[model samples]
Target: MSTHRPLRIVFAGTPEFAADHLAALLNSDHEVVAVYTQPDRKAGRGKKLQPSAVKQLALEHAIAVEQPEKLNTALAQQQLAEYRPDVMVVVAYGLLLPEPILTTPKYGCINVHGSLLPRWRGAAPIQRSIWAGDEASGVAVMQMEKGLDTGPVLHVERCAIDAQETSASLYKKLAQLGPRALVTTLDDIESYRERAEVQNHDAATYAKKLSKDEGKIDWSDATQLERNVRAFNPWPFAWFELPGGKPGQRTVKVHQASVSQTDHRSAPGTIIDCSPAGITVACSQGALTLHSLQLPGKKPLPVSDLLNGYATTFAIGVNLTNVD
Candidate 1:
């Protein structure tokens, strides 16, 4: 337990992951003097200016919030300086804090990262874990420096990545787990004598930011489970282009799938069958069954339901021609 007066902590983060940590802090003994999040940006189909989850939550809590375009700007730095926070807690803040801002707070800025450092040290750690087929990954709360996730780890929390876990599911788990570890880190911070260890650069692996364009499905070169299912879950979903039959070439996005290593007879991307349960496709090493999918102007539905409405069979030997 912290023996010192409840420290006035400044928080910097954006997105839902950061929002979870901010919510946790609100319930703690520490005082959050200010919150810093990215500016509202165009979102959704209409591209309306929507505030970040953190910003919205902060407003509800009645906490002072700042949405600066750049931390390097003198006005932004001046605003942060005025807070005079003992420590800054940063969790997925999106923008990089400049050198002046990094050391502005008394204890410097601490980041709650979503990976076991020095393993994943970049953006999109959760998505990278699933894409890399990692069995388990966790969160690390570290003392931030200028580099990206290059800070020394102070506390870590591990969680298993089930074969069925997707980015959305794993993110939820990490969001909850991160707060527990953050509280623990703050308790340690109160002691004020612990040394922040440097990360092993040789062991570091970078997780590059994911873009919509990276979500394209390549059935010919990828496993049915990897491309047809796991890799395409939330954004930039894995999809295939069906040849022009009636209107034109339509794109179908596959969302949920299961892999089986028992069968390896059928060629990859060969639609074994499509039923109410899902669409089963053959892979090079095994088989995959897709349970959920989406087509143009359609919501996600079971492969079987999709067949009933469209009456189109993803029959065997139908090659899902790659567009890109």
Candidate 2:
């Protein structure tokens, strides 16, 4: 290890991704003076109030934890100021930092963004990158500013976007890559700050937050639909409706799929073939072979296994409606 003195760090984040970064900080030589996460929210089957992953980890380590609804209040800012941090690290913290909180620490604030700067600069970057067919995705350690994710880059860690990479898989990959990068940046933050590169505002593209309505499968482009299936897995999953069934009864979630180049004259959403391998459905440009799927209130299963019980539902020649 270098001879640089360890700095006092104040970490603010929520969710599992944030927790991973906090874990790294806890292992480092730096002193984590305090932790700030969102207030506990109701979750799960019982809808009970639950602590965030970061909060839970902080409590386990006996670190001081703060759960302010918003940081704009005087009490919140005063509490954060009491930490006397050298630098504040922010991940997926959910709540926006006011100007006072931004300048509270000696080093100001730095964020661990989920995408390469000047490309994807907002929420849902991971999912949007896969959906937009980006060849690579990575994390950027930057000096936080008033503008949303438009910060000077201190360091970056990149990784290839595999052909079959899903948001869940890519998320895990970045989660691992990000902590190491964060720790590396903290190792010599002053040097990194002096050499920080400004982002190009011209090439910036916004990654808007995802919604359940966005998950409705559009059969117009099989290639894009395939990407959508991968991007939306485990949340607002890509779904389509059976032709004859009623509104709520017809929705089917696609868990796994691949592009099929087979020639097909059937209309978009038509079932071209149903076999043990998969269910090939026609699209406007090409066909998509759905491997795993889930019906309403049912567990996801491979098409071959689903065929054993619902053969008629996915039978050949049946039209799968694209419910918008």
Candidate 3:
């Protein structure tokens, strides 16, 4: 039993990360009056319409789910006002709220952002942090304003970035950390709001959304390539063109890699060594050891396992071309 006063929270989010926060609010002493999520999107091989993770969870709990195409319309704003929410919590909602909706709530809107304020303040923070070699990553609960993530932060939970941390792993870490922080802030909302700290706008850096084209591997610097391999894992995986193959058959996705210790004088992208351990490729600054890879239409496999059948394809002296 909590001693704090219960707040009528209107939850707005769309992805798995947002669903986690909604789950926390549901378990707490707060009353979730309504839920808002993105419209169903077509996905997978069948192209069938798929409900977002947040919507599915909201339905399972019997919460009223709202899926408006855009909140800028008058009817959408009226629907939100009917909830009479004490506060609105937004987490990766994917739609911008206009000023009227923001002011409708008694306590206004607060967002549970994926990164610390004044850094990585945009769509793809987790991926961008790992891609940029950031030492730490965390979550921030801030007051939402018209500007993009420029609001004053009420509470923050920080965590260190491990040497081998991938975007997928970091995303899970923050997903767990964020909900606890949100609940804690809501426990004493008035005090947290009064004590919110304004962010330093000059220090902020935007984390632009990712695209499939950004996954192409250049085989230049071994360290950067290794970081990219980790950052883009599980989606648009880091890839390169295979040497001596037709156009459609040349793309090979790299799943796992590490900086190599072996000395090599061969040109960049040249396969210097291949064994059951891994496939070693030479780069300008250093060498990289590819532990796992995926061929066209094939599942990702360790280099040792791939050697059983595609040994000639990845043979030593073959150059992995950097061309698209």
lDDT per prediction?
Answer: 0.79, 0.93, 0.92
In terms of lDDT, the best-performing candidate is: 2
Error of 3 at 40 (Å): 1.0
| TM values, all candidates | 0.89, 0.97, 0.96
Candidate 1: worst 10 consecutive residues by lDDT?
A: 219-228
CA RMSD of all predictions:
2.7, 1.6, 1.8
Per-residue lDDT of 89 in model 3? 99
Best by TM-score: 2
Off by over 4 Å in 2: 1-3, 322-324
Candidate 2 lDDT score relative to the true structure: 0.93
Instruction: List the candidates ranked by TM-score, beginning with the highest.
Output: 2, 3, 1
lDDT of 2 by residue, 1-324 (tens): 343579999999999999999999999999999999999999999999999999999999999999999999999999988899999999999999999999999999999999998789999999999999999999999999899999899999999999999999999999999999999999889889988999999999999999999999878899999999999987888998776666798789999999999998999888998899999999998999999999988999998899999999888888777443
TM-score of 3: 0.96
Please say which candidate is ahead in lDDT: 2 or 3: 2
Clash tally for model 2: 0
With a 3 Å backbone cut-off (N, CA, C), the pairs that clash in candidate 3 are none
Clash pairs detected, candidate 2: none
